[model samples]
Target: MAAKAFQPRHQSVSRGIAFRLVSVGCYSVMAALLKLASEHGVVAGEMLFYRAIFALPVVLVWALRSGGVRALTTRRPWAHLGRCALGIAAILCSFQALIMLPLATATTVGFTAPIFATVLSVLFLGERAGNHHWLAVALGLVGVAIIMLPGGPANDTAPLPGVAVALLAALGTASVVTVVRQLRHSEHVAAIVFWFFASSALVGGILLLYVGKQHDLQTLAILAGAGFAAGIMQITLTESLHATQVSILAPLDYLQIVGALALGWLVFSELPGQSAILGGCLIISSGIYLIWREYRPQTIARRNLEANTV
Candidate 1:
């Protein structure tokens, strides 16, 4: 294993914003196409195989270009395994939610990860949370409830199962974040990425034996695009963080919801109800506040201490 190499922050907020914006687009497209594939009869487990396997070559090429093969080596294999496992579970949940719910609704629910992350820090990192943190978490839950609540018409649709799974996805995502943050201190970005896709593809390949089904050419193309978009999103997302504070970029993430809304309407003929809109607003506000709080000077100091202790 190689020691971590140091690089200075890019310090260009404009470039960071651009990367974040692109990342948001890729993520939106990934989720949208993922849902489209599901409508074509692809299951989440099968899509997970496509998402991981197709992204492997892309990640590998990028890893080689950015650094030699050595950049793919890691000091902590177990951490990478754990992160990959969490990622697979989180993505499966997200895909399941997308299949069961509308695009905008699923995207909005996914944003609740920050709320989960806040609680994770307090519980596992020995960070003391103020009342505001709990308030933010409560707001996030209220938003989810509003989204899941039945409204108007004959009530033919029930989204409770999807919303519940989406919340679990958010928790899985937060746990992955904690492990990845720790890994970044000592592992190269390329290493963290390479092993993730590599290991996930391996696991997904095995699971494919039970869940895999053939797709039409059109559906295969959609899954391939989704995989590429996911890979690009991962790369650009990491670069964005290297350039600026996550708090500054956090608000821009809501742009994905707007994108999701457009895709849901234009592609799937789905429109979010008033409750979904209101709930989305609450979830976004909660996520933004949680991210902002995490970046505060006082909080960052405590976080640093927590990291050191770990």
Candidate 2:
């Protein structure tokens, strides 16, 4: 039989975009909260450890609602654990970056996760990206250069280690995204997210033993808020995924720059220079354009495939 047409009857494309925007908004808020906590001297490991603790129960409920506990016991234990490790590393690096750099600048650099994800997908998943993606990659590199140039308006000597950590975070996160693609066919999204909290908690706790500082209840409460924010971000991300393809949702991730910039200015009194703003805009535009080019056709095809499957 011929395949059916791929049409989204329940949720319109605009709705999908709105959902993704909400998700990105949550992510930006979460990033701001993490940055705030860090300024008070919270170590990345400690911050993540607390965040994971708060997230575990919420994610557990999600896992149960999605597919019960069976979904958690996948045959691919190693893959899931590896993904969790990568997530922890990414959070650790990102928090470090946030602490050392201006909120807007650090966030702009960390937004490179999508590009890294694309490269990893091509290398590891054998996914074919067209010329537009390559062009996006090249332009993204230029954006990075603009942001990273020594003595640039956005440049800060303090963020050197943090910059390295953020790059490492990008690499690790890209690998996790590739792993997610590999497992998407078999694994439930909630299960993956659940493992993220569970594993990060356990691993981050172990790591925190070395660097953890004693904080009073009020400080602990603030740190715990980071976890709650992380949970909300994860839920938002998953819900957005349910409404649209990653490629469609990916561009919305750039909205974090706006939220971060605004929050940085309002809360932290930090402002992005003209160059930083211009470079961030170039990077975000290139990424969004590339994702749209690659995913628009593929999303249509996937919808058609689903219609036929039904």
Candidate 3:
């Protein structure tokens, strides 16, 4: 009887994992598109503008399907605003880092967001972490230290600003996710997606007016591709999370570094040094450990919820 109960849950978890892998692939493609647009002289603001613009229509269509156009309202406008601000800041810093560093290296550093998120959840959400989780977070930091060793980007150049920005972005992302978790049952997924895009587009447009330059037709086309890819990647990411626990799906995000590395090698010939690889491995190991520790219970809960709902 126990085996019968567990078998289907295991299968569901496996399916979620497969979807997450696909989501990671989509994100990799999106990152590559962003890199391509950046090379063509698109500022972070312009890229963001296009991303939000393209995302708005797609997200609205989703919103309409879920509840028509009227389904777009949110009682928590402040939450939406705060999330938009943090997300936009993160995007700008990340894009700037992409401009300066090897894509792979930047992506590896950016993966620190999960560790940050885990920590923030404890403080903000009052979620408790086990000793194993603490150990995982510690190990992740040590990995970051390895990446930021003496004569490294953290110490050698102005890369600290970018890194700091990335860290803040991670914190903001975690906050957004926590908020979403709180609203999971109350808010429709389409509503959440729509608000993010609409608020981001409005705010991004304002920012663009100050910093954006005119783009050539070719450049505009590249930006459009970036936006399209970003929207698709986001949709897949959301779907993956809906289908699984954050603990399971979040770690797969580290794969973005691998994608960035491959793209960097083939397109820009930017090879990461040995230290970066070593540090990245350590970081990834800790993240994987955290996922293993956290996901089991989350999967069980999700399976139970589904069973009860049915």
Candidate 4:
């Protein structure tokens, strides 16, 4: 009976890992497509508009499939709005960084989101950080500093503006994560996902009036692919979280850096400098350790028990 029971859990975990890998792959491809679109003269705002617009149908379909239209309904409209706003900012900054910086550099810097999230949680969520957490955060920041050091091996004419924007994106992402943590208390996942696309579409549409530019067929195709990939990434990530403990999924997020590096080399003929590689290693190590600490066996057991009860 014990072995039989364990089999299903093992299968679920395997499926979750697969889904998370697919999610990371999708996001990497989407970033590459967005970068291609930018090369063809598509501005960030237009890309955002198309991405959000094309993603809406997918999000809606998913929401309906999950629980009909009622699943999209939410009492926390303002919270959704705030989440969307921050998300849009993060997207815009990230898109700009994708165009302006090398893929590896941009991705390495953006990986600092978790570090920023930890600090923000302490400040805003009134969460107490233990010594281990602080050490992890400090190490992660050091990693970021190494990557950002001017004229470092990784600094191959990487524009200061692009680096700054990438950091801003990381900060925005951290903020969004913090907000979503709060929203989970009262909002459904479907509602949060739906509102984000809707609000992004609205915001992107308005911004298009000023920053939009003409695109050829190739650029249009790339934009559409980016949008589709974004939608798939979001859905797969959600499904992965549902199937496995977040701690199990968190480390998999680092797989994105591998994907980013591979895509960068294959598509853009770009390579990361020594600094970037070293810093990326640090960031990944710190993040994995932090996640390990946060989700130790006891904590996982408690969470599992609570989840079962709920």
Candidate 5:
């Protein structure tokens, strides 16, 4: 009887694990395709255009299934606009970084988003922080330094501009996370997601006019595939959250570095440098510590509330 009672939760956790794995794979595929597309003369702007336009149908279906027409409506237009704008910029920066650096290097650098989010929460949300916050931030910087400093992993290996762009992308991504926290108070999740896709498509369309050109059929197919992968990544990622606590699933995200390293090696003959490995370790450790610090209080408070109710 006790075993039966635990089955449902076990199933939910299993689903979370499955969905998270698929989400990671989809993201890796998208990144690889984007990188490949770039190699074929596809500009970052054009890739954005295709990715946004193609991802629309998938996002729309998910939105409708979740909330119907109501999901498309939002009371916070300005907030959505801000999120979409930031997302677009971050995505473009990521694409550009992929062009300039090896996949593993870019992936490792991109992991700084959580650290950035922590800082943003302290600055904008006025969230109080303790020693862990400083330690986490410091570790993050050190990891970046190892990758960017002379004789470090990137030591004249990858372009300096690429590293800078990747860091900016991480900051932009963190800003999006901060904005989403505010939006969650007044907006529907479905609305927030749907509108972002719509906005991306719109922005991509405008950019397309300026940078679009004819491409080989193979390149076009890859771009389309990248867009589909992005939507699938979003869908699976959402499902994973619905099934389990995000903190439970987020640590698995580091697996992406491994996949990126493998893919980059297989496809482009790119190898992970010593700095990349060492720096990635520091950043990852800091990120996990931050996640633990962020969640521990909530877990404790919930337990306290449950005990009080009993």
Candidate 6:
């Protein structure tokens, strides 16, 4: 038999971009499925349970393929526990918001995660934000406020409770991102992902006992689909981050807003009001500018010089 050629693991910006877009599409689909299930009277806890349960097999397969079962082993159990708790809370709040708000509105509000993350980095990581960073953060907050402001045109308003929940979800997500930043120093990506799914499944399972409700087969299928899509999205996103610079991939995340807008209009007959569109633009522009600023060659060189001088 001929010898098989070994493939080298090399970064490909194009592939990373494609992977990111696919991941965004998968997430959009998952959100749509969750919304559909919610409409069928599925509780947020139950939806989370099924999402984690169905996603377990896929995450296991990913972990096994990335390394072996041993790759799932972790030395930082406490860190994972904290991350899982926050992640589960974020998921619960996100699901609740999705059920109550238009899809685009929920998604637009969720974009605040990066802005929250920036502030958290300053406070927790002792990282200093430049004037530009603070400017971006302020602009992003303004955008969030615009969306959350009361009494827009009738078609543009979302429930205050839903908006509040979504903002909470974004805060939780930012905290998760900050923790993951620390975890990446000590944990393999596969191990982190595996433990997250396992912990989430356990937590969701326990919660299910209290809040789970019966569902028709179709609703069950949709819930399962949501779980499956979430797993795929996670995998693709991980791969995308591995395959390219984060800045190259970061702006691509905004594509989800477009996907959500389209899905909302087509699937739910929901159109984002003026406030959402305006706020989304501000948030996305600020995020992209931050990413560009952080990744520019001059900024990179200056940071490296500072480190060397220190």
Clashing pairs in 4: none
Q: Which 10 consecutive residues of model 2 have the lowest summed lDDT?
A: 1-10
Clashes of 6: 0
- The TM-score, computed over Cα atoms with residue i paired to residue i, of candidate 4 is 0.92
> What TM-score does structure 2 among the candidates reach?
0.88
The alpha-carbon RMSD values of the candidates against the true structure, listed in the order shown, are 2.3, 4.4, 5.6, 4.7, 5.1, 4.4
lDDT of 2 at 271: 85
lDDT of 5 by residue, 175-279 (tens): 999998778767767777778888888888898899888998999999999999999898888778777766678888888888898899999898877887888
Stretches of model 1 off by over 4 angstroms after superposition: 1-8, 151-158, 301-310
lDDT of each residue in 168-213, candidate 1, tens digit only: 8889999988777678887888888888888778777888899888
Please give the distance, in angstroms, between residue 284's alpha carbon in candidate 4 and its true position after superposition. 1.1
After TM-score superposition, the amount by which residue 177's alpha carbon in candidate 4 deviates from its true location, in angstroms, is 0.7
The 10-residue segment with the lowest total lDDT in model 5: 1-10
Tens-digit per-residue lDDT, 167-261, candidate 4: 99999999999998878767778888888998889989999999987778888888889999999999888888767777888898888889889
* TM-scores of the candidates in the order shown: 0.93, 0.88, 0.84, 0.92, 0.92, 0.93
lDDT of 6 by residue, 1-310 (tens): 1111112146899998888999999999999999988899998888778998898899889878977776677788899899999998998999999998999889888888888888898899876789999999899888877777788642345877888899899999999999987787667778888888888888888988998777889999999999999999989898887678777888888889889989988999998778877877898888888778777888778867877888
lDDT of 5: 0.84
Scanning candidate 6 in windows of ten residues, the lowest lDDT window is: 1-10
The CA root-mean-square deviation of candidate 2, after full C-alpha superposition on the true structure, stands at 4.4
lDDT of 3: 0.70
lDDT of each residue in 270-308, candidate 2, tens digit only:
988766776677778777876786578775587568668
Model 1, position 132, has a per-residue lDDT of 92
Q: After superposition, how far is residue 223 of candidate 4 from its true place, in Å?
A: 0.4
**Which residue runs does candidate 6 get wrong by more than 4 Å?**
1-8, 154-156, 298-310
In model 4, the worst 10-residue window by lDDT is 1-10
Instruction: Indicate the TM-score of model 1.
Output: 0.93
